[model samples]
Target: MQKKSGLRGIHAGWYAVVCVLVLGLVALVLYGSGAYDSWRDGRSLDQACDGALAQDGLTSALGSSHLKAEDGDDGSLAGCFVKTSPGTGRAVRVTLRWSTDGAPSGSLVWYNADTLGVREQAAPLGNGWSGVVRYDGTWQIMVALDCANQKNKALVAYGDLYGASSGTALTGLGRVTTETAKKAAAQHGCQVKAGKRLTRVSTARLGEPGTAKPLGQAQGSCVALRDVPGAQSGTPEIMEYPADPDAPQTNCYLATSAKKPGYGLYAYYGAAAKDFESVGFGHPGGDYVLATAPCPRSTHEAAFALYRLYDRDTGNYPVPHYSDSFARSALKAFAEHEAEQRGCGEVRIMSAP
Candidate 1:
């Protein structure tokens, strides 16, 4: 009888253990399923925010007259525009926004448009947020929804929609007032005024490179020059085409001496008909000579030839002057001219000195 009692007690203990395990499994399953509903609600909110952000980007683009709305998939949100400038080449700016609502836990992610990968993530903002993105030669502006309770993520993606513009930097003043934000949005469109000034000669030094003249004395039509302090050694070497075996190509070598090599400027010119034929500067029936040379090193170096082959028969001559104070102006003018010749409308200038 005592042995029977011991067996019964052991069986009761095992039954209690099994009951606890079954209850724990049930609890786990309930929590997992219950959490999904909340996730779905959050995801719905995220989709709404994405739509709103997309509208904002489109409104900014259309209202500013920078782009026309293109046909897209139903419920899809995207917009873009093309811009052109005399100095800067062509570029397109686009904006895109998307979201995920089903994840229960709130999360926001920022992505680089080119890679389409997350660049940042955090809790959603209460009102909205914006980011600037660059891919290839394009620039994008992205804005997203600021969720109140859950993490609602939105994005404003801008593409380099138009040709290049003078000012390349995309500034984010973070959390600006609606009016200010609207102005910034308008800026992304073609209606946005151009803020970058092209390279020009100093008014006071219009005809005088060596002399320090009054600020207003320089010419307004001058080209922008690039500063190459160690160009003799550090400057990129110029590459020449096979047709023009004797023509100087764009080349730069760093100066090895302690004393920097005096600045070497180039005067770009379109050769005359015979000269063009002799050096292969121009094709058959082309009137302009495509040539560049080191500018004469002088304090008073005032003028450099600027030429453009408009067509086989016509060419343009825009004289780009040089000034010590406006050294970059000439370089910019020449670079622009080169871009135009190459049929490139946009150019990027790095801020590195």
Candidate 2:
């Protein structure tokens, strides 16, 4: 009887050990799975949250506000308002949408994106991209992204940031905007990263028809002249936020050469020069011996200078004789281009001195 009892005890001990081992294996598997999920969550947060939380950056961009997205508008717009507190009224809202069809045209995208690129490079983050997008009435930050390895879709962020003019505020909203994009990156396969780059305006000037390549579009930049030693080149400079804020004043110098003993060209911006018809460009009235003309109904000015008062090499010049015709042609083409791109009104020609 004593031997049977000891045998039963030994069997029970073995069973206990077996059960312990099985439970240990199960716990290990669960822990491993949980650990893997945690890792994935961290990575996912990096894409959307990391860049948005730069408190000390130049823009002092919007940090993690714990925003939650609900169903967006019915018209291809998926957006969420950043509430002041959970389940309460909202303060700021950031929203985004992507579309393959009915997307903004490439040139239109280029026109609007060019300005924002200058305004905000890192706003809050970069998606490995270089441009932005815009719509009518309100100014917003936009980006072009590729979804699902196919060349498709654009990302547009609009903050109802009306009457707000702080750079901090602008970029703060921008950060939220990009964070929203990162959250969608995985679902849409927004494979391409984004960054900022200035839109390049082509340097080629107006030449004879069919001979010279057309100049690249300059949205908010001044296509004016900056002199180098050997040959003339186009120097484009950002003149305020023309496209983004739609600043009223802007100019484009069609052509320019070096100082005296060289050649030169000039253009009028949003300046109104009177006495141009009576006094003329070369007359003793204004600076640069530059011809002036009324822009008529358009608030923007019009005029171009080929051989201003102080031009040198007056003897062996390439384009000689009254270049008014030249200025007219260049100005006409530029005005037309602006109308086509920006819907600027007619630039009726007035007389030159």
State model 1's lDDT: 0.27
Each candidate: what lDDT?
A: 0.27, 0.36
Give, for candidate 1, the lowest lDDT window spanning 10 residues.
Answer: 112-121
Off by over 4 Å in 2: 1-70, 86-90, 103-129, 132-139, 162-165, 196-220, 224-353
Question: How well does each candidate superpose onto the true structure, as a TM-score?
Answer: 0.22, 0.34
Query: Model 2 over residues 1-353: C-alpha lDDT tens digits?
Result: 99999999999999999999999988788678675444443443343332232122112222333333333343434544333213333234444555433322221232221111121111212333322322233335544343435443444444433333345554555554554565556555566454443222121112212322212333332222222211233222211112321211223332223212112232322211111122243232212223333333233244433332222224343323334444454444444444433344555544443
lDDT of 1 by residue, 1-353 (tens): 99999999999999999999988888777677765444443343234322222223222222232222222222324333322211233333333323331211111111111011111111111122222222233333333322222222222232333432223222211111122223333433312111112121111210113322221222211112223342223222221111111111121111112212112222212211112223222121211112232222111111222121121122321112223323343344544544453333443332211
RMSD for all candidates, in order, please: 22.6, 17.1
